[model samples]
Target chain A: MPSTTSTRPGGRSARVRAAVHHAVEELLSENPAEAVTLPLIAARAGVHPTTVYRRWGSLAELLSEVATSRFSGDIVVPDSGSLREDLERWAIDVSTDLSDPDTVALMRATLGSAAEGGCACVGDRHAQLDAMLERERSRGGKAPGVQTAADALLSPLYYRALFTTEPMEPGWVRGLVRNLLR
Target chain B: MPSTTSTRPGGRSARVRAAVHHAVEELLSENPAEAVTLPLIAARAGVHPTTVYRRWGSLAELLSEVATSRFSGDIVVPDSGSLREDLERWAIDVSTDLSDPDTVALMRATLGSAAEGGCACVGDRHAQLDAMLERERSRGGKAPGVQTAADALLSPLYYRALFTTEPMEPGWVRGLVRNLLR
Candidate 1:
């Protein structure tokens, strides 16, 4: 069993956690992901090595936590009255997030590794979408088939981000939402 | 400059080519792609080290070529009576192909490295799709918007294959096509 650093009785616990996460993001942004290690992260964060090791157990787990926590903030489901408008806004926001080089590298790192925890962020986002669609269904609106709509609208931005250098242009996002609704 | 083995006029030349491609497929199927190398591939292929080196200067380039050639066989554009029908068939076939473990590994390999040639295969498939849509438009069918349709139908398969462990069930494929058309 690992020591419970998050629950430890120290005023510095929260600061240490924030510093570690920020260090991970900055390292990922400036250097290759493979070069990042717990010791390196600890050194960058000004935390002790034993504390980092005790908390995370492994680099993959640490990265997984970082990815999930960082991206959970980005998955806010828009409730703009219409599913179409909501999807349009969601896709554009996601595209903007993926456009950042650091975000792209983080996604690439998560995909390259066999970390199940890394995909937890995407799963959370999916759940948010499902809830939105459920709300629409309860409102006497026809079921928009949210999973299929997500596949159609969201997958392309990911495809382009991972497979090509194509920009996820605003026009493309709008057209994708329009076509899915049509 | 690397020697042109493909242009060499010998019975062994073709045999060597097939063996190398088969070896690459076997290695990818069994091992982590990062651990694969030209020397190991030559050993597995039973071709000379110089030959593998001569043809592909780096592991990334070799893997990219393997990915492109293997997937090219999977991109058959169906010409059914209607765009909807054609899309349905294509989606199902692509889904089936992506279901194969070997095909999945090959895609994972290509994506783990920076290989522009690896993406050429997908580009070719997109072109085939574009041509099919163009033909439909010429036949007095409303322009079934090639890029948007591609995002709707194709990107989902790739996304699910890479991002999730979910089985691309046949019922799911049918439902996706129906929803897109609706």
Candidate 2:
């Protein structure tokens, strides 16, 4: 069988992976969900279709590589001793990050794409969110009230972003935190 | 200039209206968003595109007609005195209705179709949700413990339905109500 690898041997593999990542990002930037096709991604990344398929298995997986690259950076969890304050800080940061137009659009696209069929990317996204929540809980110290606190802190931001045209303002985040904690 | 009035002093006007309404229901049943083009709708209804435009003015209005025709029968909100029970009933109904594979697929398609570009249907859907919330609040009464009982009551059901493949079971709805009430 002919070798289907896009990378020839050793040194070229890293370069090919980087190229594919960049191409996926560029496609998402242009058209969120509409631009994610395997052939187009392969052409842009200068790899054969077989190579792309061999590497990621599916277009959703390829897109997952691009989407998650930006999210793995350090997420600081403040420990101000007060659970309310800690949650407030976390909500502010999360609301600000999630309220970005591009981010919201990308999320909507991801949801839409997943609704069409199966995508491991959706599972990865959920895992990432769960990890972030877990980290925050650990930092602040979980109480009996932690799960409800977490839901109250996060659900509104997501609901607002999905249903309303208005960007989630800092004021809303602060209000949500205060109300939930109180 | 031809009048855009739906009710005309003619023989075929009433028949045409009925046919259009039936066609809208049939099409939406099959594929909510895909089945809503003016030409296709008119063809299915055995009417003219001009007639559809004359009556509804836009695709969103046409969709609204279909949705209202199908699901607007009656949503009885019982005043059980206990917010948890009332919410449980409401959540079960909403989740059960939305969890229908056809309904879920249709909603996804409608949402995705709206995300693709400017679709008045988006605004219409939001308005409908808001209206439903308002009606429930007035009918069911509210609890003092939660910030907004409505949010706590409804958000999880929606979030779970949108993200997970698990069927919305009665136990899940009961658990959600219990958790929110806590």
Best by DockQ: 1
Estimate how well candidate 1 is docked, as a DockQ score: 0.32
Query: How far does residue A97 in candidate 1 sit from its true spot (Å)?
Result: 0.7
> Measured against the native two-chain assembly using Cα atoms, what DockQ does each of the candidate structures obtain, in the order listed?
0.32, 0.24
Q: Residue by residue across B65-141, what tens digits does model 2's lDDT show?
A: 55454455434554565555666776687777767665555444444333333222223333334444455567774
Candidates in order, TM-scores: namely 0.81, 0.64
Report how far residue A160 has shifted in candidate 1, in Å: 2.4
Looking at every candidate separately, what fraction of the true A–B Cα contacts under 8 Å does it contain? 0.27, 0.11
| Residue pairs clashing, model 2 | none
* Model 1 lDDT tens row, A4-28: 7656655467788789989988987
Look at candidate 2 and tell me the lDDT of residue A145.
47
Q: Per-prediction interface RMSD?
A: 3.9, 4.8
* Most lDDT-accurate candidate: 1
After aligning candidate 1 to the native by TM-score, how far in Å is the CA of B13 from where it should be? 6.0
